[model samples]
Target: MAGEIPRAQPPPAEPDPVRDAHPYVLLWQWRRNPLRRRTDRLRAWIALGLALFVLLAAPAAMYAVGDTVHRHYRSTAEHEARTRDQRPAVLVHDAPRHPEPGSDEARETRYPVEVRFTGPDGAVRTGTTDVEPGLPADSTVLVWVDAAGEITGPPLTADEIRSRTMGWALLAFLGVVLAGLAAHGVAGLVLHRRNLAGWDAAWADTARRWTRAP
Candidate 1:
């Protein structure tokens, strides 16, 4: 029995390097480890704060901004509608079969037609304005005007308001996201630099002690 050789215990299994480095390295703040430093914990909290701001505060801010813009647009549109007037106008003559090459028609796809309408002063007035193409002579079309019968732009419609609201909302969302990303990027850069500086100091101290050893 004394001369019998003891069998060697099975070699310990090798730990996986990748699994040891967890995917969510920031979670190291909560994990107990001798290597986890105070800076690491601070960085983890900063990361958590960034995540909360992106997930929660960003949406809240976007909603607030969108609501404010929507309300303002609605109020302005309502006011414009109240102040502007649309009146029936008749084409005084047939619109030209071919419009000018570089006229508003080319852009808006509407032709300029001569039209006549009664002004607020009760006098007949005539002017040429952009209108739908292919209209016969004396066809009635509604045109926006001011109290002086001067042609003006119509008020924003319900559809326009809705479209504007959506655009503003999208812009607000993008603004928040970009700001959050920028802040996170800057914070990460600063933390990385701090870690590198700490490493340099630690290495210097270790080398100095090694040199001093007899």
Candidate 2:
């Protein structure tokens, strides 16, 4: 081994104790790094935009649905009432049928009978009238019929139905909006955590490569 050409033994393999430790070190390093700080700020902006979008869109969507429902109910109630008022009264010869198995055969004539009317648009409507039921047939009374020979019931007000429907729609919309917001917030948090983890791993890889060179 003196000058004859000393046999070179390979350098002992160094155990990479820092390999596993590097990830934690890089995570800490990234927390203090300016570039990562900028990314955090950007994420904050994205979250803010998402919140603003929900706030702005929810009310508008709710308004549109409410408006449509209100219009439908209003038109339906008004058309029903108008049709009922125009229906011609007819006379019937029958006895009133009481719920009781056997009741008195009362032949009382009265004005205004409730009748159901079908509009030209095929919408079924109900309205009450002061038409009288005439005659008696087997203890069953015949009430006045409309021009179309349909029974009419109590009329509903357009405004009342629209108001009630609108209120319920608003409540449902609010519930959906709240649920969406909660989901969005959770998603944002999960994204932020994943991004942070990725950044840490990348930093550790770069540091390890640089240290091993030369």
Candidate 2 per-residue lDDT, tens place, 1-214, comes to: 2224232333333223257567654344235554445545555566567667778777877877787777777777777666654433222324234344333433334444444444444566554444324424222222333335455563567668867777867875786688667866677677667666766676666556555635
lDDT of 1 by residue, 68-142 (tens): 888988998888877778888999987655465556765567788889987777888987788866678999988
Candidate No. with top TM-score: 1
Give the backbone clash total of model 2: 23
- Model 2 accuracy (lDDT, Cα): 0.55
**Ten contiguous residues with the weakest lDDT in model 2:** 135-144
TM-score of model 2 (CA atoms):
0.43
- Residue 20 CA displacement from its true place in model 2, Å: 32
Estimate TM-scores for all models: 0.67, 0.43
The lDDT values for all models are 0.75, 0.55
